[model samples]
Target chain A: MTDALLRIEGVSKRFGGVIASDNISLEIRPGELHAVIGPNGAGKTTLIGQLMGEIGPDSGKVVFEGNDITVLPTWQRGQLGLARSFQITSLFLNFTALDNVALAVQARSGHSFHFWRDARRLPELRVPARDALARVGLAGREDVVVSNMSHGEHRQIEIAMALAMQPRMLLLDEPMAGMGPEESARLVETLRELKQELTILLIEHDMEAVFALADRISVLVYGRVIASGAPEHIRSNAEVRRAYLGDGKKKAAGGHG
Target chain B: MKTIFTVRNVLVFGLLAFLAVIPAYADVTGNTFIMTLFTRIVILAIAAVSLNLIMSYGGMVSFGHAAYLGIGGYAVGILAFEGINSGFVQWPVAMIACGLFALVTGALSLRTRGVYFIMITLAFAQMIYYVGVSLDRYGADDGLTIYKRSNFGSLINLSNKTTFYYVCLVTLFATMYLVWRLVNSRFGMVIQGARSNDRRMRAIGIPTFRYRLVCFVIAGMMCGLAGILLANQADFVSPATMHWTRSGDLIVMAVLGGMGSVIGPVVGAVALLVLEETLPHIIAVVGHFVTGLEMTAAREYWQLVLGPMLLLVVLYARGGIDGLLRGGRRD
Candidate 1:
């Protein structure tokens, strides 16, 4: 019970001459919504990419469920119950909203080689897919093609996909980007509900949502974490203000909260 | 409800009916040319359908699909030369050879993307084509002739044109049905998602490459079956069966029909071959009537018309003939 669901121990990633994730260490306990926020180029996405097994860290290791998963490929990491949503609204556009989530549910289910019957009619797949869509407020839009949906809706579908996996840990990158206030509010509610069930590491630029949802906040700057503390402490910290909050132009240029 | 005909459903039903009726028509007409032409179309359609599994659904544009055709054809050719003419033996050998080739090629080619993937697959197929050309014992560049069609041991007399046509038709329908099941399955969903956005799939814990490789193998195996049928139809096999240009022809059949829909390739096969058969006659008539031009010269220039037709399809009819038939609808 005490073991962290995901632990990044001195994990660092370098892209060419640039350091994307500087020897950073973080631990996420169960049922915690830890938000990693930073200006642009902060390596928050890269760090998540490393943890999700999409990108390998140049040095150090990532341990998930007491297993060193630094060398594991992205799909293998998924099999171990680590799920992530993209910063970009990446989804299967041709699929109906339900079908997109159904695939995630399929990944977690038994082998997908069951070729004879239609997967869409199967209760095992469709039931979980419908539940996931309902969780993300897309119950009515399950039949809608994802490409025809709005950007905000696509983001929700992405979240629904991650949720459908029934993952032990969730890594979400900028889940609220490109959303209107109403959509953001809805997503916040969905995240709040999800936080109670799954361990979440959220990277978001929406300050209000970040402060509202994250139990702990880690501020990343130029591929390094300059500050990590309680959200209240981060909100009032002078160094954070000087380096990030105080510079409106810099923050705007660097991107979101 | 008007039953809301989708391009997919229409193509599927249309192909099935056409395949079902072809043998009966051949039985009545006694024109074996129609059966032979349809057999060629159906065999190629199998290749196109198999390719659709990866190219359209998986978003992998492999220019080397013809390589499987070569492998399958050569398998039958070499085996028949060695005094083995069993359809059962030749078909499995063809399938295994293509599957193995596809596995190795897919593994290497999957490491790349976009045009690079296309080029790598083409290169691998070309390698096989040249290898076939070098096998002097099996006729090499000259080609090998099989004296007899595959021996099915009295259950089906493939020597009978109608029987062979039905066999090709049945195989085509089976291949189409299998692909349809595959695309709608959970595995199919992953492959399609991987095609649409691979980065997103990987982010969601789906390892897309391995799934794609498996898909590549399945497609190759299907194409290999088409190759065996093709050898039976022609009673010969050669490097020309697997030439890179022939691969391009398969792509044309796929694109000309529509890439995504299961039966689009069949429609393309039927349309392309029908045009090839009739266009020369029509052109010769026009040439002789309009300007007193020789029929022989016009026949040799049929490709000029086909070249422009493909260009038009690429430019204006991006969805292919199926799109036109469905009135601008897409699958």
Candidate 2:
């Protein structure tokens, strides 16, 4: 058995004639923050979709925690300790913020077939839901309904929901997609703290956050990983510079790490 | 048990109080017709409450909800035809038959969504409606009349109009309480969350399909009970009870009452049925004065007012009557 917590071996996917994931393969070792960075249309989201079982790879095996999850449904993957945060904030808009997180907590805690007790009145669920919200700096805002929350707050709730599931690994797709600068910084800090306790597959366009938090960075260009190594190696990789940084641009090398 | 002490809560309590005292007022006024009309309203309100469970809360708009009414009614009618008149035997059979139908239809229909879901459910309900029309021994499309109501023995008297009305009212409130408890429960939350965002629910490990199917079946069974009561109240069963227009009426009631709230559809039933009873008369009186037209002609044109009024409500009252009562606030 391999030591990798998640192994993507020779995965390829195509949307008709468009080669979205071209025989790409990567491994995420246990308890390490692995960031996949690419420009627009580098198949970043497609890769996440395949891993989460929303899109099937034409020819590849996705092994997670010693199970081949290539054909498993999205809910099964979630039950196997795999969680995803949508690039666009998706939450129960009509429910309270606490109710949203409580549902996620409810997923992992037990079967949701209990139809008698009020979930809102249950301390077992609401308490950890509150804890999850607090972890994402949404402490006092638990009672605020998501419909009234800001876009940035929705992003935070997305992460909080994943956290509430208590998954062994997280497949975060652009967690900072629409966050303001202040919100982005706060999320980066949250992710940094989160990485201390979990394995993370981060897909982001925020170069500064990538350089700051990623243990190892992989540069994807045109549905292929051209370089995968430490932050310093990727910062100086010749091909990555040409394809991503456009070579002669000043501050071309990302040195935040 | 935590009361919001809002205006909405006050109105809901006030409405309940009015319903509670209706029997006493009807007895004093010797208005048995009013009692009969309100009894029909309470029975329909139960069915609407069941629809609200999945329709509004679960985001499943089944356009053939009246199928359960027919199925339950047929179960009672068919059983009575076969010499089974016990409420115990008839009621459970009705529930199981409706539940089984819901299970099968829901399994297939849940595979589709949006307008397709609406169409598939409508198709299933119509299929049942025609089936009801073809039951030759049960009087087919002409309907069947019962010689006696289900024998409940000494515990309850179904023959007494006031007793039957009270029974319907009590059962209606019980259903409301059950639904209120349910929506606050874990199962209800799962259904509501799936309604809001099914994809996210799966991302967090909720197998939403099974829950949705169970919810569909539960709603069907509840409405099935309403159907049993409806057959007893009418002392008859017919294919007309399950017609497409009746299904549309239920939708209008749920939407008008306020789908998000449990009691909203009940209010909707009261409003729609009450309007149906009184509007034709009101139009006849007003039109005779204004247009100097014959009473029947004026009454026949009442829908012109109703059509515009429903359109206005749909456009302006996004949350329906319950929402309007709460000043457009959603629960």
Q: What tens digits encode model 2's per-residue C-alpha lDDT throughout B1-331? A: 8557877889888988988888899999998889889989999999999999999999999899999888888888888888898888898999999999999999999989999999999999999999989989899989988767877889888889889988999999999999998888999999999999999999999999999999999999999988988998998999999998888999999998888799999989988899888899999898778878777766777778887877888899988888998888776
Candidate 2 structure, TM-score to reference: 0.96
Q: Candidate 2 deviates by what RMSD?
A: 2.7
Model 2 chain B: ten consecutive residues of lowest lDDT: B293-302
* After superposition, candidate 1 runs with Cα above 4 Å error: A252-257, B2-19, B23-30, B288-296
What TM-score would chain B receive for each of the candidates shown? 0.93, 0.96
**Judged by lDDT against the true structure, how good is candidate 2?**
0.90
Model 1 chain A: ten consecutive residues of lowest lDDT: A248-257
* Residue B202 accuracy (lDDT) in model 2: 93
Each candidate structure's TM-score, on Cα atoms with residue i matched to residue i, is: 0.94, 0.96
lDDT per residue for candidate 1 within A1-257, as digits (tens), equals 33888888898888899888887988888889999988888888889878877788889888998999999988888888988888777888888999899888888886666666788898998999999999898879999888899998899998999988899989988898888889999999999999988899999888888999999998888788888889989989888887777778755332432
| DockQ of each model vs. true complex | 0.69, 0.86
